[model samples]
Each structure stands twice: as structure tokens, then as C-alpha cells.
Target: MSRKIKVLQLQNRYNVNASDLAEQVIQGLPAERFEVTTAFLRGRPGPGEPESRAARSIYFGFSQSDLKGLRLRALWRLYRLWREQRYDVVIAHRFKPMNMLMLLNRCLRIPACIGVQHGIGDFDRAYRRWEARRLLTANWRIVGVSRAVRDYLVGCGAGFDAGNTVQINNAIDIDRAERLQHPREQARSLLGLAREPFIFGAIGRLVPVKGHIHLIEAFAQVQSVYPQAQLAIIGEGRMRAELEAAIARFGLGGKVQLLGAREDALQYVRAFDAFVMPSLSEGLPLALLEGMSGHLPVIGSDIPSLRPILEDCGGRIFPVGDVATLAKQLGAVLNLDAEQRRAEGERAYSYLRGAHAIEDFRLQYLQLIEQSLAAERAAL
Candidate 1:
């Protein structure tokens, strides 16, 4: 019988989306052929510890605030663990964890490393671009969560081997998403929202990159024509003060509300007349998927990261960061009759189910691992 391949999944922190993807990957792998463990490169576990669903989990203590100090501490600690376990593969998600694994591979000559690029914006920094070109050297493969990210990495001269760089989009749980959604009336009641107002909802971090300011601006414009319209933004971030000021500046105090972060946020998706994501950048956002899964017609920025999904799922798109265009799109959707809006949403859900199945995502990762392992053996 063939020995089971032991794999380690690493991430900088256990944020919701990253953790979810890691858990799905671990859960989906064939038990007889693979064993998986997960580790976080920074931060201590909160309330319920070891959030990832792996056979085993570990935490490597290193402060994110101190880059030089982190390198010394993480490198020493990871080396000790790598020598002891001798894992067959180490799949690192996001930039910091990937960079750490690449450095470790260079020094200790340990396991085969896989770097997963969950997004694309990080390379904007000179230091990150330099590190990308200099550090990644080993038996390694890099997976981008979207085609745009893969193209961006190669365009930046990151020196990733042409043959090994690839794209595997983040997958969604269509069944779970559909089950989580409540009926429109019940969902509104659950959130203490009134049904009379035409709700335009958005869920994302309130950071500048999310373009909440622009969304708020666009919604204010939509209010000029559709006075009954209200905007509800879920999630919290450092930009609250600025966003609040924008609301006041536009005199949308009563019309717009920052709902903040809610654990049950996705359940309330159906409460909205339509869902929108005004992100300036993204790599297959999970919120968009959940919105579609709830059968809400979507409106999003026409950035490369979102085009593939919007084009397939049949949503309205506006130019990135253009408030007037977004307002125009919002007005167009709001003008649709209930039946017309429902039909658009149904089309989106059908496309989402057909294209982004969680099982297919799992199978692709498994195949990648198997091929990587086989290539390694053949080389020897």
C-alpha cells in the first residue's frame, strides 16, 4: 500500500475567508491518501482555538508589527518543526506565510512549498515585489485565486517559473449558502429592518479599498430618484469615521446606516432588494458569491477581478471607483419590476451553482498535490 502524504497548510492569520478555504481543502482531501495539518504564522487564537478543520493544528508565535524580528523567530521555529515532522508539502496561503515558507525552504531544504495568492494588491509595494523575485526558490508552485492575480504576478517580474504558476479560483458552498438564507420578509424581521424601503446592501471590510465611500456616494445619488431607497452596509473597519463623515456630508443621515459586522450577516442577504460590491480591487470575493447564492441581483465594480464572475452570473457592472456610473447602474436595477429583478437573481444563482461548486475546488487542489508529488519522485 502507498504511504499517505502528510501536508501542512499555513496562513498569516485565521481570518474568516482564509480559514474557511483552508478548512474546506483539508476536509475534502481523500482520507486514505492524505493527512493534513494547519498552522498560523501570527496572532494567538481567540475564543475557540485552532479554527481550521485539519487533523492537527499548530501556532507559531511571531509579532506582525516587527518584520525583522518575525523573520528570525519564525525561521528558527519553523525549521525545528520541519526537521521533526518532515512534511511532504507545505501550502502557504497569502503573502507573509508564503514568503516565510519560501525562506524556510531555501535555508533548511525541507518540504515542497506551494504559495497561494489569495489577492493581488500586495505587489504594489516595492519591498513585496523585491521579495517576490528574490525569495521564491525551491521545489515550489504558486496558485493565484484569480486569473488577474496570476497575470499581475508574472507582469511584475516575480520570477515565478512559467510552468508552475496557475490560477484556481476560490470556491463557494452553494448548498450551505442557499440553506442559510431566510425568506425576504423573515430576513428583514430577523435584522429589525423595515420591508417598505428598497434596501441596497453591501458586505465587506470598511477599508478604503472596499470603496464604501464611493458606494455611499452612489447610494446618495440613487436616493434623489428613489427616495424610499435605503443603504445598509455590513462589516466594520478603520474607515468608520470617514464613512460617517461622508454620510453626513451628503446629508444621507436617515437614509444610510452602517450595520457593522454581524456573524449572521449572510443570512440577512435576502432582506436587500439587491446586493452590490463596490470594491476597487478583489480576488473572487466570497461576499459576492453569498449574495448570488441568496438569489439577489448583484452590482459590482467592473474590475478584472470581478468581470469573470459578473459576466457569467449576469450582474450589472460599473467602472471602478466611478460613483456616477455606479449610481446609474443602481437606478437601472431599482427601476426593474419585482419579477424582472427576481429573474436576474435566479440566473445568477444558476450560473454560480454550475461554475463554483465546492467539490470541484477540492478535487482540483488534490490533483495539483498529486501531480506535484509525482513530479518530485520522477526527478529523484
Candidate 2:
């Protein structure tokens, strides 16, 4: 902790989870104690924004697919740049270059290397056999955002040191989400929602793994009984045309709206009676945490990572693709008495603030960073 930690996060370029987390970390850091710098694989900060106090935010690639052919080329460029700089520590995030960095770290002896697990990916992830084996056979420290993920690594025999695998839940900034002081009616009208129907919403990039199609079908079943409840999904994804077509096919056009990703994610959440995340997989979803922070009780798919987080809140969980069960859970929650619903929202919000607020997460990052640095020096 004596030297200013210079962290080089090899994460995504589109400013999603990793970038968003980095931004909050900069804003929340005890500036006097930390100096941060970054190297991403995409776009630059826009228009003189001081998002990071680092000397610069360098881009190595702009899109996920861009890394395929030029990965080695990108690493050669990054290594040259890194060689000129002396870093106290380097924490590489997920995949490609990060994996590449960890694989080559022994040769560099970069002092300390940390790898953050984004999720307990599906069976398909076994393809990273060499990298997984390298982690088991090498000296890198591993961190998972949720305990479920940590357990998965241990079960897989990833060979992390006994104490090297740490569980750090992703954090949320409750204050940011709390800004939605607008009345529910106002939120509904603003989002072009009917003034009186029950609103059920979910947010995430519209990918197949997100389980959006199942949610659409589940909501359709729920509307059969209430006819007054509506589902609004907020996110931008390649599946828009297909999702829209599915909604029409279900004859739920009047009951569902696909509000593609928005500037303020909570704005749409504020209009919901309850939020839903039917993800087949996740890394401690930010959407569920944010929705709950906004005091919207949630219904999630029963996945290993999300189950433990939701079970305590009277959160309802159904089988991954069970439309009947999912619809039943949604209907039951929406049918609660006004006081009961308010109490549930309050409980959900309290759970979020207690365990997952943004400030809490920022502090956790600093602690982990400082701890990793200390561990290195202690060994010396």
C-alpha cells in the first residue's frame, strides 16, 4: 500500500460492466492514496471527460470480434507500451488478452497478477482448457464476484492458491439509482406506459443467454389473468427484430414493450411494479441490484449465481425455461396487497443497500487492490 497502485485492467472496450465499475472506482477512490491508469481494447473517453485521472485511457481494440485475428498483434503493442512503464501491480480481467497476459506473466514477473472471474460460464467455457489449466498450474490470484463463482472454480480444480480465490460481490451505487424520485404515474407516462397497469420490467443486453424469449412468453401467460399488467424490457441487442416478432406472435403487443437500452436504467425500473431477470447465466447482475435498489421487488431465474442473492428477499424463482412457473411467480407478486408490495420493495431496497450498493462495491475494490499489493510485499 506504500506505493501508488498502478492497475492495468485488460477488459472490454464498449464501457459496459468493467468500464462502468472502473468509472465509479475513480470517483470513489481516496484520491490521496490511489493513482489509477488503464488500457482497454476500445473507444476513448468522449469530449474532455475526466472519467479517469490516469494519464490516458488507451484503446487496443474496439469490439469483441476485433480481437480474433489481431490478438497477438494487440498484445505485442500492449507489451511494448507496458515495458516502458513500471507497474506495482497488474490485474487482468476476463478473456483473450487478459488470459494472454496471465499466461505470460511468469516471464514478465510483473510483481503481482490478479484475475477477476466475470461468471461461472456454461459448459462451453471448457474450451479455455489451456488457460484454465495454466491458472491451475501457475501463480496468478483468482477472484470471483459471487461465492457461487468461487465455488465453481474450486470444484473445477482451477489450482488457485488456498487463499487466492476471493469472493467480492459486485457493488451498486444506491444514491445514483435513488434519483428516481418521480412518481410512478409520472414514470409510467414518461415511458409511454398505461397509467394504471401493473408494470413488470427487466434490463440487460438482449442476448439469448439473457433469457428474454422465455420472459416474453412468461409475461404473456401472466396477462391472461390480470390483462392489466404489462412487461417492459429495456436493453439494446441484436435480437430486437426476433423479440418483437415473438411478442406479436404471442398476441401480447398491448401487454409488452421493448424499450431498448436507455440513458438512465433506473428510469424504466421506477415505472415497474416489479423487475425480472430471467438470465440463464450471470455475474451478479447489475440490473437486478439496481432494480432492487430502486425498491422494485424482483423475480429471477433460478441459476446458481442469482439464487442465493434472491432467495432471502421473498424473491420468486422459477425453472430456467418454465413459462408457467415464471408467470405464476410474477402474478403472485403483482397480486400482493399495496402495503404488502410496498413492504416487499422496502425489504428489497434494504437488502441491496446492505449487501450491494455502489459505494460499498467501490470500497471493496480498493480493499482488494490494497490487499493484493500487501500480499506481494509480505512474501518478499
Q: Considering summed lDDT, which 10 consecutive residues are worst modelled in model 1?
A: 61-70
lDDT tens digits, residue span 125-195, model 2: 65565456664423467777776777876676545545777777777667756775356888777778888
Best by TM-score: 1
- Estimate the TM-score for candidate 1: 0.91
Instruction: Judge candidate 1 at residue 344 and give its lDDT.
Output: 96
Point to the candidate with the largest lDDT.
1
lDDT of 1 by residue, 182-272 (tens): 8989988877778789999999989998999999999989898899999989899999999999999999987888888887578889989
What is candidate 1's CA lDDT for residue 215?
A: 94
Q: Local distance difference test, per candidate?
A: 0.83, 0.74
Name model 1 segments beyond 4 Å from true.
Answer: 16-19, 124-138
